[model samples]
Target: MELRHLRCFLAVAEELHFARAAERLHVDQSPLSRTIKELEEELGTLLFARTTRSTRLTRAGRLFLERVPYVFTALDQARASVQDAAAGYHSQLRIALSDGISPERLSRLMALCRQDEPDVAIRFFEVPLAQQLKGLHEDLYDLGFAQSADVDDGILAVPAWSEPLRVAVPARHPLLAHKTIPLEEVLRYPLVMGDPEYCEGYCRQVDRILRSVDQVPLVTEQVKSLNLMMALVAAGYALGLAGASQIQTCRESGIVARPLDRKAVLTTWLLRPDAEAPESLERFVERVASLDAERRLTT
Candidate 1:
């Protein structure tokens, strides 16, 4: 019935142990039990089944659990909306960023937005690909940038920018003899790649590119952060693969980037809810689009 009740129920549902759940909620076990009991009585359903040794959710509880998270999400969105309104802000744009986007391009786009519409405030969130998709659907984010274009039916993913994929080799490495390295040659060395879990979009693109190689990739390390990967590469432990923008922006010590022989590119996409966009957002997106078009033509 109340937010606290839902919180208690969720905690109990997840832990399936009264004492553990109480500890997690930072409450006494007696009151925690009372809260869950009250919730069950109010709903006229048994939410949990308990025995001396174990506790599990009832059928009703399982169904309720499926829908309870959305309630909290809605409450959070409402609170943020009220706070923004109280601050006397006319409009706000929330953008979620997943992976490493080109820093130079992001700077230029933000500058364009400030020049065109200084009144609208913009906020950025560094999130995972899954979180970005969830937030967009829940109205928590207005736009998102990710490496992949794959999205659900109601979400629109438009290609926003593309950077040529390059190999970051340690200084004085033998491969540095060639200006552009072949993918097959790069795979022959110990490679430090992005982790598939954190960098899902980027890893997916890398996987596609590696499909051409007959030899299994000699992956020495998988890292979630580019800085860590660069460090590993600089140590001569492995070769790093990344977009030209990342290598340029990082300026990592003891690491030099070389273009790949093939035209392998990492594409960043603009993800938005498939609904009518606000005029301010439309203007910002259009500016990004024009910039991307120009960059493509010149390159």
Candidate 2:
């Protein structure tokens, strides 16, 4: 019914313990309990089930939890928009990044945007592929960059950039004996791969490449980020599979990036809603295309 109600509900839902939630909110347990009761009375549904020893969310509570964060996200964005307007920005762009987009490409694109449209405020949200797609459909993001072109009906995906997928090998590793490592040979050793949950598109692309070979890969670790994967590889824990640009940007020592003999390429896609595009988004899309063209020319 109010901001306080949502805040108290979220705290209780997250903590699942009234006393702990009260402590987290810096309030007494009695008031927190009364607030939850009042919210339940207003909603006409039970939110949490509590026993003498434990507390947990009911089905209604779990469902309500899903929509609660959007309220806060909208509020935060509203506050940011006011701040941006006060700073003399005419408009703001909400861009999301997923699947560990190439840092070099993003840096170049950002530099171009700042140069071309200094009045536009650019905000980047690093999220999973699913969240990016959902935000696009929900009008939470103007556009997003991801490694996969796959999407549902409401979103359109366009290929923005492509780069070779390379193997990250530790220095002095046996795989380094070959200039271009074969897929079967790379699979022979343990690998540090991107987690499907955080890097869904990247994992899908890498998985498709690995499927070309009949042998099963020995994945020793599933990392959430390329840096962690490179770290594991540099420590001789396992080899890593990542885009050539991602590997090139790694500052970790003792990591040698070798191309795959099969020449698999990872493509980054620009995902947007299928509806008509705004002028700013149109310009941004064109900028992305120009940058990709320049990259292809130099490479």
Quote the positional error of residue 165 for candidate 2 in Å: 0.8
Enumerate residue pairs that collide in model 2.
none
Deviation (Å) of 248 in candidate 2? 1.3
How would you encode candidate 1's per-residue C-alpha lDDT over 30-113 as one tens digit per residue? 999899999999999999999999999999999999779767766766676677778766788888888767788899899988
Segments in model 2 whose C-alpha atoms lie over 4 Å from true places:
4-38, 49-57
RMSD list, candidates in order: 4.2, 2.4
Which candidate achieves the best lDDT against the true structure?
2
Evaluate model 1: give its TM-score.
0.77
Cα distance off (Å), candidate 2, residue 102: 0.9
Q: Among all windows of ten consecutive residues in candidate 2, which has the lowest summed lDDT?
A: 66-75
lDDT of each: 0.88, 0.92
- Residues 1-299, candidate 2: write the lDDT tens digits: 88999999999999889998999999999999999999999999999999999999999999999778777767878898999999999999999899999999899999999999999999988888987887788888899999988998989999999999999999999888999998999989999988999999999998999999899999888989888999999999999988898999998999999999987999999999999988999999999999988888997
